[model samples]
Target: MNIIQNPDSTSLKRTIEQGTADQRIAVLDIINEVRKNGDAAIKAYTEKLDRVSLRSFLVTEEEVEQAYKEINEELLTIIQEAACNIRDFHSRQKRESWMTTQENGTILGQKYTPLDAVGLYVPGGLAAYPSSVLMNVIPAQVAGVKRIVIASPPQENGYLPAGVLVAARELGIREIYKMGGAQAIAGLAYGTETIEKVDKITGPGNIYVALAKREVFGHVSIDMIAGPSEIVVLADDTAKAAEVAADLLSQAEHDERASSVLVTTSLSLAREVKKEVYKQLEPLPKSVIARSSIESYGAIYVTDTLDHAIDIVNELAPEHLEIMTEDPMSLLGRIRHAGAIFLGRYSSEPIGDYFAGPNHVLPTNGTARFSSPLNVDDFMKKSSIISYSQQAMLENGRKVAAFARLEGLEAHARAVELRLEDL
Candidate 1:
């Protein structure tokens, strides 16, 4: 990791902005083809991109049963436990419809309704994340989503990952599709013969999947167009260099474009953490990817003060922020922009990613500045409830009509006037 002395804010901003125009164009073409040709286009892209011609897109019940037997009992136990933790955490975020009534015979409220069906895109092949299955599916389940299906790329052997299948089965999700990429997204947005159109699509994927989500956003609700994973560790002299280095590498190993940064007040700690990162990278199985990420996007900014460090963190609005100072909680109130926060040295980023109750699907590419982590609310919709008695309408209708007339909307004015005339 390179050490910089007070880097410029613009340079920091540039690291998180990802995706290319050509990539967008390619994804658009794939989406258009899938929209026009439907199931045939999905098969062609799956064969061409994933190198496997799938006979059937849906996973059978027998296959799901075999997946349970294929994985060991020990792993299954862990997945179940993790699912419970995720469910318990998200259950707290569930909301109920509320109403307020007035003596004037008017009622106003908001109704919370779960989405009818949702599509989950899980990346398969080399990238297999069963944790993602738990994180994305459980929230939808808590929100009472009726139909949930997963679309993952099939391997060269034309089978889904046993871990992913096992996780989905644990959540009672049966509809697993053997498809991926932009075509899978297209199929989900505009249904094919095999796949049903979903109201919303969630989970993370590569650039093509991200761009496809961007294209089909209006047609179907999407969680967010997630970028590469990123982590920013705000450490002080009290922080252990080795622990900070490990946390940074955890995110860096996710992808070659992943950004790992350390903003600290202590120059000595920054230098030590830099050396520790190099030592830890050598032993990692994904050292090449981590090394590439660290060299290109990772950096250690040694600020003159802790306040300055916090300022830089807010400016970056990282997906994950770790406060490794004397009192990590003391800084929590000051952190205005972060997808998820790890309070102390022990609260590693992976805890939230895997076993911890909180959702790991977070906003990336500085989206934490305005957006938020994926939750039960993402799978739910809200409708405004309005009811007016005859007396209420008789008192308010003329005012509403006059306002509509002022806006030159005669149709809106007449609608209110008609109700008023009946009253």
Candidate 2:
């Protein structure tokens, strides 16, 4: 880790992986093949890429039972408890259809409707994240989404990870698919023989999966084009160097492209955190990845004051922001952008990732400035309600026609005028 007196905009800017031209072309090819061949194309890709041949992509009840046996009762209990927390948190975000009456005899309102079906793409191979399952599924379930599906790549043994399966089972998510990468995205976006199409897709994957989401966006709704994991620690002199360093490395180990930054007012704390980051990274199992991330993207900025540090944080709009200052709550009003904020040292970033009940799937790579964390609202759509009484239509219909004609839409004007004449 490097410590600088005052870092500039370029130093703070983090880059996300945008797939290469070849990868994009490959993704398009896979999508097109799936659209044309459906199940056959998916099977071919699974065999070629995953090195496993399968006649069916659906996970059978027998396999789900086997997955339960593979995971111990203690870990299963933990996953169930996490699911309850997630469900409870998202339940508060549930919305109901509402209407308001006006003096002019018009009813105006909004109707909230849950999406019929949604597909969650959990990453497989190298590692399996049961946490991702709890974070993504619980919100949709809370929103009353009837059909929730899980799609993950199968290992060479032709089975999804035990943790992944166990988590899905705990959530009562029975529709599981053994597919991965662009093909899994394609299958979810466009219906195949075994896998039905979904109204929306959410979850995270590699560069290929991200690109596939971009390609299939308009066809079906998507959460967001997520980037690599990121963390920005806004600390002051009161913050401990070891605790801050450990928190930063928690995100850096996620990927070589992951970013971990520290913005502080005290120069002493900055140097201490920089030293502590290296000392902690030495023994990490993913030290090579974390070290690469730290050397390439990590930085410690020593600002003249806490206000200046907060200004820099707003400018970066990082995915995860940790405030380890003396009074973390006091700075809450100043923070304008962050996917998730961890206040105080005890409220570490991992708390939100696994068990704290907030969705771990968040906007990344400066996207927090405009987007938001996944919640129940993401699984629901809104429809505007409009009912104008006869008297109300007679009063506003002419103005509506005039406004439509102002845009040179003759039919739109006539449509309103025709109703007005009847009124």
Candidate 3:
């Protein structure tokens, strides 16, 4: 990792940003072909992208039941516990369709209602993220969404991972489809003869899957246009360099494009953390990917003051941010941007990914500034509820009419005027 003493802010943004126009165009091209050809396009894309040839694209109830018997029971327990925690936390986020009455008998308020059905795409990439399944599905369940469907590619033996299936079963989500990538997203968004059309789609995938979601947004709602994984640690002299480096490499191992950066105020602390990152990176399973990520996208930038460190973090708007300074709370008010902020050494990023109560499906590639982590809100829709008595309409009718006419909407004005004409 290169040590830049007060590096340029623009350089940081250009380095870590994801989701460019070219990527968007490529994804759109794929989505268009899939939209045109339907199942045939899905078959071709699956074979081309995942290198798997499938005879069928659906996982039957019999198969799902058999998977439970095949896998060990111990792992199932862990998935169950995690599911309960996720479910409990999200259940708290449940909202109700509401209405309120004015003193003059005018009824008005916004109504919160869950989507009828939703689809989730769990990527069976380098590793199967079963935790992701729970993170995405339980929120929909909490939001009282009626039907929750999930789609993922099968392994070489044409079977889904036990952990994933187990997670789904725990959530009572029996709708599992044996399809993935852009095709899986297409299946969810447009609906196949066998698969049901969903009101929205959520979960994570590769660039192609993200692009497919971007294209299908208007047809059906989606989580976000996710990008590559990233982590930024804002550590000072008090931080344990070893733990910081370990957390950095954890995200790095995801892929070469993955990024891990550390900004601190101490030069000695910077050197120690750099050495610690290498020491930790040496004996790792995915060292090849991690090493390249740290060298190419990772860095140890030294800032003169804590404010400067906060500035860099805000500009980056990293997906995962860890603050390990002496007074981590001091910087809390200062941090204006980031997907999920990890405070102090104890609040590591992995906790949020697995055991922690918060949702781990965060916005990436500088989207933290605008977007938020997936929650019950993603699965629900809102409708404004309005009801006014005759007297109430007469009281506010003139204001409503003039306001409508100011926008050159005579019909809108007349609608209100007609309602109050008898008054």
Query: Clash pairs of candidate 2?
Result: none
Please provide, for model 1 over 19-111, each residue's C-alpha lDDT reduced to its tens digit, 9 standing for 90 to 100: 698988888899889888888999999999999997788998888888888999999999999999999999999999999999998999999
Query: What lDDT tens digits, residue by residue, belong to model 2 across residues 310-381?
Result: 989998899999999999999999999999999998999999999989899999978999999999999999
Give the Cα error of residue 92 in candidate 1, in Å: 0.5
lDDT of 1: 0.91
- Number of backbone collisions per candidate, in order? 0, 0, 0
lDDT of 1 at 201: 94
Q: Is candidate 1 or candidate 3 better by lDDT?
A: 1
Model 3 weakest lDDT span, ten residues long: 10-19
Could you tell me every candidate's TM-score relative to the true structure?
A: 0.97, 0.97, 0.94
lDDT of 3: 0.84
**Model 1: per-residue Cα lDDT at residue 288:** 98
Per-model lDDT: 0.91, 0.92, 0.84
Q: After superposition, how far is residue 233 of candidate 2 from its true place, in Å?
A: 0.4
Query: What lDDT, from 0 to 1, does candidate 2 have?
Result: 0.92
